[model samples]
Target: MTNTADHGRVRDSYDVVAQEYRDRIGGELAHKPVDRALLGAVVEAAAGGPVADLGCGPGHVAGWLTAHGAEVVGIDLSPAMVEIARREHPGAEFREGDLLRLPATDGEFAAAVALYSVIHLDPAELAPAFTELRRVLRPSGSLLVSFHIGTEVRRLDEWWGHEVDVDFHFLQPDVVAGLLTGAGFTVEARLEREPLPEEAETRRCYLLARRD
Candidate 1:
């Protein structure tokens, strides 16, 4: 179960750092060839259908998808983040929403991407989150998720000089895959990579799944 208080903290923290976060991480895809490649695959899989960028901070991922010919909607928990995303990436739609209970209709998207976004969720919340993702996706829709690979929770009291509270929960790929499977998604592909020099020193895991 997702703690409402924790969710509020996460939202507030992101709201506090929304601008700085966008300035720093907005253009990250330019340096990540693998991430760009996977995102391209997502665009192709969508076949011009609308794609959902879940946990889309500043709308960078959604913007990239829109630039690549996919219709996109970006969803974030922070209203400030959504505002920045809308202002920065006018081509894609941005909305303030939670992962556990998305503000979208059932089967509303042909594909969805949740890059490094699920890390904010508690381990027990993963199943429900994935189930919600599946609920919003069309049958056989593609889903891509990425997160830090570990079994630890890293809490932050401050970010970019702003006082805040947030917890980033590292996860095991196998456990995530199992949770996805239990949520009615079929695991398709998995990739693990070392962090780039500019990124935090942690291994990252990406999982591609299809709604069934």
Candidate 2:
């Protein structure tokens, strides 16, 4: 189970920044070639079935997946974020959901993407988050997860200039890979890349895994 306080903090923080977050992130694909390519491959691997975008903020990623021919459903912890996602990507479905205890059925999706979404999860929630992800995927289903690569807890008192509370946890890639493996996922690929000059200084890690 997710800690209520922790979940509340994350929800409220994103709620406070929902519109600003959408304005800034909704068009990020225009500048992020690598992310676009990775998401493209993920959609291809999904093979035309439904894909879940966990922690989908404004639904840009889900929108991209929809354009690529895969059905997409975006889930976020904040209702405000889900609202923005629904408005921004009318073709795709959006709903409020917790990563550690997703409001989804077992084997409900053929693939799932958690792009930079796990950054908001505290250390203790990581294991259960991945477990819930695996539970929602069919056998041999794909999972594409990305996160900042480090060992730091970045606390924000405000976002988009709005007062709020949130903690962004940077985790080691190997540690996350191990967590996925222990959760019954077969780690297929891992990539680490230096941040683009216009982006944050922190390195990013992407892992592609499959439910065994």
Q: How many residue pairs clash in all the candidates, one count each?
A: 0, 0
Q: Evaluated with TM-score, which candidate comes out highest? A: 1
Lowest lDDT block of 10, candidate 1: 1-10
Over 145-182, each residue of candidate 1 has an lDDT whose tens digit, in order, gives 99999999999998889999999999999999999999
146 Cα displacement, candidate 2 (Å): 0.4
Tell me, by lDDT, which candidate is best: 1
Q: For each candidate in the order shown, give its overall lDDT on alpha carbons.
A: 0.95, 0.91
Cα lDDT, model 1, residue 172:
97
Please provide the root mean square deviation of candidate 1 (C-alpha atoms, Å).
0.8
TM-score for every candidate vs. truth? 0.99, 0.98
Per-residue error for 163 in candidate 2, Å, reads 0.4
